[model samples]
Target: MTQNQINQSAWAEKWPAPAKLNLMLRITGQRSDGYHLLQTVFQFIELCDWITFHPVDDGRVSLQKPIPGVPEADDLIIRAAKLLKAETGCEQGVRIEVEKNLPMGGGLGGGSSDAATTLVVLNALWGLQLSMEKLMELGLTLGADVPVFVYGYSSWAEGVGEKLERIDIPEQWFVVIKPNCHVDTKEVFLSKDLTRNSKSIRIADFIAGQHQNDCLGVVRERYQSVKDALVDLSEFSEARLTGTGACVFAQFDSEEAAVSAYRSLQKKWQVYLVKGVNESPLFSKLKSGNIS
Candidate 1:
């Protein structure tokens, strides 16, 4: 069915905000604008944070449960809803309920994914019918990672992560380990010793496994927890940092291998076995008519 044909009532159903992993991250250069020029591969995982929106006639966007330490005014989900409402001049509001599962500050892009899902789902829910390109454009104002989620596909990304080319990648299982501490992205990026001049590589080179997370060395040196987790996980497979991370993941050809790794690691650290996905679960729900 066409987006315009989707009933507004369908907006009431829950939607998914899936997590993403940077299969590889390379820092090519720093722009004059202070944004880092980068090349990265982004792939989604089956794990997700669920969101539900309830229409409110009062025309004031709010959240059912405010995320601790984040004011409603600053919450990305509410901000996304308000942005959409103001952009379209729609006389509708929503009480957003978030079932957050993804870990914050794990480099999993949880908050950005939530913001992207808010933009995508609410456009249809409010009957604004904005195109995907327009939605992604709006998402970029929230965060660099937000556009990828709004694009709803695995992608090869560059130019501070806004430029995207959708790519199909091998579907594999990953053993992900989350350490006990948070790695501040701003701190990692601002470190004096951070690598900012990794040689640029081609997509073909990335597919052949020739790229690495430039932020990993800085992060490991600054955070002992992350260092320990990476050292432990690397014993089983080639564990790598995902974005400026407190979390590291290793890909395996089969679920059984990933599960085996998870089982061994869970005894010493927090771990999960997840499958890589090319398509976002939000799109799957829309196609299956499961949104309502």
Candidate 2:
């Protein structure tokens, strides 16, 4: 069958859009083009926002349920679908339904993961059969973090967070807390007090516990809720902010320890106990032919 005449029901299935945590974020320098040079480690967490696509023969991309306060045009999922359609001259379209469990602006890469899932799922649904490199390139147009989700593995990243090399790390449990606030990443980056220069360290140094987030100081000073979350969580373990701000996390040796910490904080904050994985859940489903 031609693309426009394909059956919609056959392609309908749920796909995972897994959240990520930045194990370490270091600002190595600033680029002349106004982008920050970053050295960071990205690992997937089992926490995810599930997305399902229903093919539409009308050739117009849309969201089945629009997110509050966000216009459909501005939704990254819609943008991703449109970008894929336009780039490949595909006649197929889809209505996306997002079960948004990930918090917005929480430094958990929720939106980027949603966008990456859109690109990956649509590429397959539309039968475009695009190469992995091509999908990663398309994902980069959505956001810096989107490509990592597209790559579908834990990775060490550099160069505005695009250059990636796959790395395997311990599968530890984490207690993630989202404070009652939003952190604007742009504001954090623009802060004059933000650390812009730090000596680059090897992965060995990271394993040796020689890394810290350069944005932590500015985030702590500017966002009191984040500061409070950090201080409170630290009482249980060494809590550190992920990505820019608004969410802080601490690692534990076992699920019981992480759950204990999470239980203590649950009444006061929005918390999650997630297991870190080297491979994304999205890829796991794909490899197993759970979605096609």
Residue lDDT tens for model 1, 55-130: 7889889999998888889999988988898888998888989998999889999999999999998888777989
Writing each residue's lDDT as its tens digit, candidate 2 over 161-276 gives 99999988899999999998999999999999989998887888887886599999999999999999999999988999899968999999988989899999999999999999
Which residue runs of candidate 1 sit more than 4 Å off their true CA positions? 1-9, 290-292
TM-score of each: 0.96, 0.96
